[model samples]
Target: MTGISKLLMTLGVIIFVVGFLMQFISLGKLPGDILVKKGNTTFYFPIVTSILISIILSAIFYFIGRFR
Candidate 1:
């Protein structure tokens, strides 16, 4: 397989694993996440979750790059 195909497959597997874990994990409700409610309206944002995911992915890529 080509480089692009390998990258795509890796991404697909990562997405599948994340989706499966999300079914059993309450990541969206993590602390530092924002939740605003007004009368009949509500808004939510997972800032902490995003940052944590970013850091985790960064480390993963860093290690992968080092190995490569």
Candidate 2:
């Protein structure tokens, strides 16, 4: 297959695996994530989760690039 097609397929598989694992892993509620409650207001942010995903994706792409 073409390079773009292979890359897209690889990403799709990665997303599928992550989504499947999320059923048993609670990354959204990680300790460093932020949750705020003020009277009648509430806010939630998944900073840690975002960072973790970013790191993981960076590493994955780094290796993928190295191999290619």
For model 2, what is the C-alpha lDDT against the true structure?
A: 0.90
lDDT of 1 by residue, 1-68 (tens): 59778778777987898789889988778989999999999999989999999997998678666755
Backbone collisions counted per model: 0, 0
Q: Candidate 1: lDDT of 14?
A: 75
CA deviation > 4 Å runs, candidate 1 = none
TM-score: which candidate is best?
Answer: 2
What would the TM-score be for candidate 1 when compared with the true structure? Answer: 0.68
TM-score of each: 0.68, 0.80
Name the Cα RMSD for model 1.
Answer: 2.1
Q: List the global CA lDDT of all models.
A: 0.85, 0.90
After the best TM-score superposition of candidate 2, give how far the Cα of residue 61 lies from its true spot, in angstroms. 1.2
lDDT of 1: 0.85
Deviation in angstroms for 10 in model 1? 3.3
